[model samples]
Target: MRVALMITCFNDALFPDTGKAVLTVLRRLGVEVDFPAAQACCAQPMVNTGYLDEAVPVVRNFVRAFEGYDAIVAPSGSCAGSIRHQHGLVARRSGDAGLATAVARLAPRSYEFSEFLVDVLGVEDVGASFPHRVTFHPTCHSLRMLGVGDRPQRLLRKVHGLQLVDLPAAGECCGFGGTFAVKNADTSIAMGADKARRVLETGAEVLVAGDNSCLMHIGGILSRQRAGVRVMHLAEVLASHEGAA
Candidate 1:
């Protein structure tokens, strides 16, 4: 199957490792993963921040970039959610019938990492092995927007030597809704503090989530609090094997 990797804006600049890990894991599974050069943000930031008019070009660029690909995949649940759920709204709001149709055509073909791995590819164990006790925080987009129930956890469970611990309030939002963090600093920090406390209570070595933004928000609080826990992207853990130092 031909897969196009849509590296989200955050992942492209901050956490490129997640993108590489996604590529590695997919290639290991014999899937032909392609990186479309024209891909950029799914225009989620503009759309979510009430800048829908400014998001047209970005949406158009995204549609044109991977229009011919068999499937478009991203390592981020948030970006995938944006493409699947928001692109059409932006297009329709701008009164661009052509763009709306293009977005409609492209949205359903996009899949978040775990959704593509378990649902599209039909494989759980990518032969990954990681010797660590880890707890997962289900990002709101993955859980609610995409409704990816337990698919990520199921994949993690099959990893050799990896101990899966239950996270307290795993379904709670990490409070990093992009601009939401900036608009409501106290509320965002409060929510993040709660999530960080849950991570600490789990006593896991690391907190993993599909969305880096959420991980960064909660991880920052844990770091400042000296909580002795590290944050990781789901792809990084899923791509690990015994030989990969």
Candidate 2:
């Protein structure tokens, strides 16, 4: 299958390892992956921040970069959610019918990393090994937007030596709604603190989530408080073969 990595702007800029992990694991499975360098932001930041006019060109760039690929994959559920659910609306608002149709064709073809691995590739275990206690946080986008269900945990369950612990209030948002964290600092931090507290209660050595943005938010709180836990992206965990070192 011909697959392309969207490599969302945030991941490219901050959490590059997640994108690398996706590429590593997919190639290990013998599926050739392409990196479309023209790909950039999914315009989620502009759309979510109420800058609709500014998102048009960004959305156009997305559809243009990913249009011909058989499958477009990203490590981020938030950006994937935007493409699948919100990009069309942005296109319509731009008054470009062609752009709207292109987005329609591309959105459904886009899959978040875990979603692509288990759902599209029809494989659960990617033959990974990580001898550590890990708990998962279901970022709101992956749960509600993408509706990935138990795919993330299901894949993790099959990893060799990886223990998947239940996260308390796993469904709650980690309080990193992009601009939500910036505009509503107190509320965002409070919600993140609660999520961090729950993560600590599990005593897991690592906190895993599909979205790096969410992980970063909770990790900040845990790090400042010296919680002694590692924050990992789901792809990184799945990409582990010999062991996560």
Best by TM-score: 2
Model 2 stretches with alpha carbons more than 4 Å out:
242-245
lDDT by residue (79-127, candidate 1, tens digit) is 9999999998898988989989988988999999999999999999988
Worst 10 residues of 1 by lDDT: 236-245
Question: Which lDDT values do the candidates have, in the order given?
Answer: 0.90, 0.91
In angstroms, the error of model 2 at 35 is: 0.7
Q: Please give, for residues 79-141, the per-residue lDDT of candidate 2 as tens digits.
A: 899999999989999898999999888888999888898888999989899989999999999
- TM-score per prediction, in order, is 0.97, 0.97
Model 1 quality (TM-score): 0.97
Clashing pairs in 2: none
